[model samples]
Target: MDTDADARVAAGVTALSERSTERAGDEFTRAAWLSLADPRSDEELSPFADEDRGWVGEGLRWLVVAAVSYRVAGREARASRRGVEGIAVARDLQTTRSHPAQRACLDEFVADFRVAAGMDDADAAYRTAADAYREAGDAVDDPHRLATSPLFRAAAAPIEQVARGPANGEIAVEWDDLHGSDPSDPGAFLARRATYKRQRFPSLLDRVVDAGRLAAPRGTTEYGNDSFRCPDCDSTDVNWIAGRTLCLRCSAPMARA
Candidate 1:
């Protein structure tokens, strides 16, 4: 039987079917991350787990999706204090997302978010992703720029930073909120919450990392996606921005790349 990429990755399978356990480090990883939040069952996460180390910049995207899932479920789970299912799903997803291939160069993202999901620390994931927003941008201008995956324009728009980067990622939640007076079943709550998120953020992964690039003081020299260009330097280090091909460097409007 043929196993999908996500399942393979989850089981620690090699990237290539015939090759040894080596990193593909090519456009495939780009394709994978860009589609992780595609709302399909193709399993984009599998390929990303073994991509080249440089692609770690994409960690923000994964972190963002995981954070959203965690937050929504965590909230509902708390409201239904007796239900551990929501929390379980959140913890598993967060742990998996938190541990993309080590070569991705995403720093300690996995460590930062593991506890948050395991113990319902939603802020830890979001706050850490916020810091990464700046870091990802700065790396874009470096000699070895932070090469990100394909995504939408607003996906990387600095103005669209989803959650505000609070000084503290931790907050006190009253016990009352846990297993509140809500009358919904735990399973139903999680199902609805997950569905709502999937619909609202169809491309949650793309938005998170791409927004990180935009949120920074700089822009990204991203690859893949549609086409892009810059008017000033004519730099094509761009990606799909809303409806235009925006320049990462000068932020000037230009024709397609």
Candidate 2:
């Protein structure tokens, strides 16, 4: 039977099929963390234990989509949130159980995240160090140092630096409002709240158009849907104001005659 990339990484079976077993476990573990963080299906999780589960599971992905609906057409915040969430999910998955090959993959993946997150979040560094310790064992006890490999130790160095750096007071919630809410079930209260917010911000130019009571000239569709109707006169005769549609008859200034 043909197994997917995830199955190969999680089980370390595919890595061994292609590469050496020495660090196959770590490599597989890394792959699992990275994949789980981005996105996956229930079928994919079947091979993994509880520890391998995604950060918030697949449900949170939907919530993220809902959140993006509130932001502008293409804001950076939305994209950044998605990227960070992926990293967070992967970090959670890395600590999960894995075969020898899978474990090595995970170590490398964890090491990579540690370096990235260290740029901003200090806690990430400490977490990486702890993971390496668990893998390698105590410094005094490990003589041949077979318990954990050098790569594991190398991954921990940068993490330690992060822990010492100045701390930022920013909070890291997946979705502030979506918390304690279910993304799978449409009826969830958070989902309802999100819906309301989406409706409130329907378009960026709603008010200036005056209750959407106006529209642009028939020939002018330069702004596309951004055009608005004059709210006061209830006419299509409106002008763009602060990126909003405003009625020319109501508050719009006439051109110099």
Candidate 3:
């Protein structure tokens, strides 16, 4: 196995998951504290309090699921030679501009990342995950929906394991599965579910990436031009938006080249 490649993949996933998880936790904590600090009586706040709390709570749950999924995927990437090879392939695709499938994956990944970042409230998070889940169902049934490269399929295998549904004899991971059960100890319940989901399905990140790629733009680049490339990733999918230049592939801010 390529230990170095595995380590790099693990580190990247760990960093992304940890940072996202921390941000969600902070948001939830801040909201909770603010509610407590509010001068309004419980009766006065009751009308809006449940709705607000529900939103934050759902976002926190999804973030927790994301963190667990990342950890599992990272471990899987390090567990076998095939996983290492997959990581290598994925890295290569990220830097190469020759393949249409590569471009599709990059665009999908960027869209997914944007949605993950925008999980500011429960409704948004729930809708995003639900949409992703529905899309996943469709993609699984239609193999030719996206012109998936063999390399992309191989690279995605480890991550895809975490997204499989119970219908496939895998552990249940849909949002409904995670939310429907109400145990006395919510933390313990979530821990159990996370453990089960880790063994079976793809991570939330994987689902989003897969779903977005399934709906990938065909025959054209969204913002990419042959004249510009991201120095960090050697990708030509760079664009200027909102007064700053960004690499859609790697989300790196770069000066125009």
Candidate 4:
């Protein structure tokens, strides 16, 4: 990801962390901390056996291929191979520039880095990631800005449904209760607005879930309700989740049904 985009995601993570800490209560935070402490048990990295192995699986396959190819290749093939691999992962995640600018920003970085690597220019690659990220920032549309830009609706398609519900409002309230954001205050309004903006994208959520930045609930079908899976683990059970179901064991997310 580009610096600016990374910064934005970082900012969102910070917000999510704070909110999680505040609203999820000490129990949730402690559990999350414990999970973080034990990366192996960390729910983030835990295998979702029930998940469908469709585009996401394909993307992962490409990622492995790309990474292996990069590692095995001489310096000449490094940049392009890695770049394509990064894009492959993004595509697998179903991220697109049209909807989630933040995601697009990161993908742009992967693309830029590939070019830099090809040119044998490290600084250029980094700068490209940074510039592209900055440019992408202009396209961002969070909940507060959603009404003004329907583009956000499409980008947020995956997560907006979750974020807009009363549940998220509860989450937001929980955030204020702990962090002390005064909803009635104008200055606090901007902070809240930006905070929600930073936190409200499905693509962003996916990245965090992948990166282990957020705590995902275990038995919730919200994770993989769109796909089918083995009654056991999601693996490539059928190469896709046959039903919009979740893992029965851990409630891990999936996309097959």
Per model, how many backbone clashes are there?
A: 10, 27, 7, 23
Candidate 4: Cα lDDT at 162: 25
lDDT against true structure, model 2: 0.30
Best by TM-score: 3
Our tally of clashes for model 3 stands at 7
What lDDT would candidate 3 get against the real structure?
Answer: 0.32
Q: How far in Å is the alpha carbon of 46 misplaced in model 3?
A: 8.2
Q: Poorest 10 consecutive residues of model 2 by lDDT? A: 164-173
- Which 10-residue window in model 3 sums to the lowest lDDT? 212-221
- lDDT for each residue of candidate 4 in 1-257, tens digit (9 for 90 to 100): 23232232233223332333122222322232232233233233322222221112222222222232222223335435544655544444433234333343334334333432243443343344334434444443332343123222222222322232223211222333211143233223222322333333323333433333232221123323434554435432221121223233322333345
State the local distance difference test value for candidate 1. Answer: 0.30
User: What shift in Å separates residue 58 of candidate 4 from its native position after superposition?
Assistant: 8.0
Between candidates 1 and 4, name the one with more favorable lDDT: 4
Each prediction's Cα lDDT score?
Answer: 0.30, 0.30, 0.32, 0.31
15-93 per-residue lDDT for model 1 (tens digits): 2211221221122233234434332334434423433332323333333323333333333232232123223323343
